[model samples]
Target: MNEAIALMKRHRSIRRYKSEAIPLEHVRLAVEAGQAASTSSAIQSYCVIHVTDGLKRKKLAELTGPQEQVRRAGAFFVVCGDTRRHRLLCAREGRAYEARMEAFLLAVIDATLFAQNMALALESQGYGVCYIGGLRSQLFEVERVLTPPEGVYPLFGMCAGVADESPMERPRLGAEAVLFENKYPDDESMLGMIEAYDERYARYIERREGAGRGWSGSMTKKFAEARRVDVGEYYRSKGADFS
Candidate 1:
């Protein structure tokens, strides 16, 4: 495989970061590379917020699952699914538009593309990166801090910096379990593949965490819990009109 393929294969989320700071110029270039990411219909319905304040980072860490990575990373960014610019353009041109589910999905797709591109770009620059999904865990606090408008929502955030350590890549399910041909195989066939995968994942987790709960056990526990997140409602309240 080529360099890009090799790099992607070795991808790992890094939470432990060194204290060294990344130059602002490089940060801007990485963001520009993110901007180059494929946008849904070229709408570019996304935005990024770079936060450098120490106190604010601490506050974000507290609100976002108290993740130390947010506070400790050399550079932090919040990627937002935005429709504000589109709304403004529509209003200026006397065009009719409503923030529906489709619009929301497009915004999310655009933002996700940008974030992934940014991650790759930063990694290519020799920076370790991690995406903080915890931003969604506490919506109100994140909204308060970001102060986004009605046509914008914080999708996720990223932390990038020099790495303190190198970690092993996590294992993934085999092609048989995930990648189906034109037609999906029978349930039993898939289950058989997953059974094999479970054994591999169990060993992986055991080696990594010293406790091997395996795939089914870990996923069962994760899904068994009531994760009552009002994501759709929150977005609706913030100008994501599905009607």
Candidate 2:
């Protein structure tokens, strides 16, 4: 594999980080690389906030499932989908900016692309990084802290620093399970692939966590009931329009 590809494949989420701080210049360069990611209609509808305040980091760590990595990482960043800038542009030009489902979708995709690019860039520089989706667990509480504008909302958080530990890369589904030819595979073929992966994943879980709960079982339990159901309301509060 090529160097970049190998680097990507070696990706692991590092939770334990050293106290050493990453240079602000390095973080800026990584974010600049993130800006090079493709955006929808060149909208570039995303913003990153580096949380430097010690108090705020502790609060955010509490709000996000008490994930100490948020507080301990050398740098913490909140990635948000921002349509507020476009709204401001519209106001400047006397044009009405409409918030539609398409706008919301575009912003989300653009933000995700930007974040992944940033993560890759940081990892390439030998910094360990982890994404914090737990921010969504208490989105409203997070808002009270971050105070994003009406047209912007936090999608996730990220932590970056020198790693204190090197963890094995987690297992992933094989290409046969996820990749498709020109057409989608039949249900039986898909289920067979999943069953095979489940067995492999169970072994990995046993080795890693001392338990063997299969992937499907965990997924089923996790999704059996809707989580963060108020997320739609949270988005609506941010003035996102699905219509």
Each model's backbone clash number: 0, 0
Candidate 2 stretches greater than 4 Å from native: none
Across 1-243, the per-residue lDDT of candidate 2 in tens digits comes to 999899899999999999999899999999999999999889999999999999999999999999999999989999999999999999899998886988888888999999999999999998999999999999999999999988997999999999999987788988877778899999999888888889989998999889998989988999999999988899989989989
Please state every model's RMSD to the true fold in angstroms. Answer: 1.4, 0.8
Question: TM-scores for all candidates?
Answer: 0.95, 0.98
What clash pairs does model 2 have?
none
Clashing pairs in 1: none
lDDT per residue for candidate 1 within 1-243, as digits (tens), equals: 999998888789999999999999989999999999888779999999998888778888888898999999999999999999989988899997665888988999999999999999999999999999888888877778878898998888899999997988888999667877799999889888888989999899889999887788888888998673777677877888876
Number of the top-ranking candidate, with TM-score as the measure:
2
Q: Rate the local accuracy (lDDT) of all candidates.
A: 0.88, 0.93
Alpha-carbon deviation at 60 in model 2, angstroms: 0.3
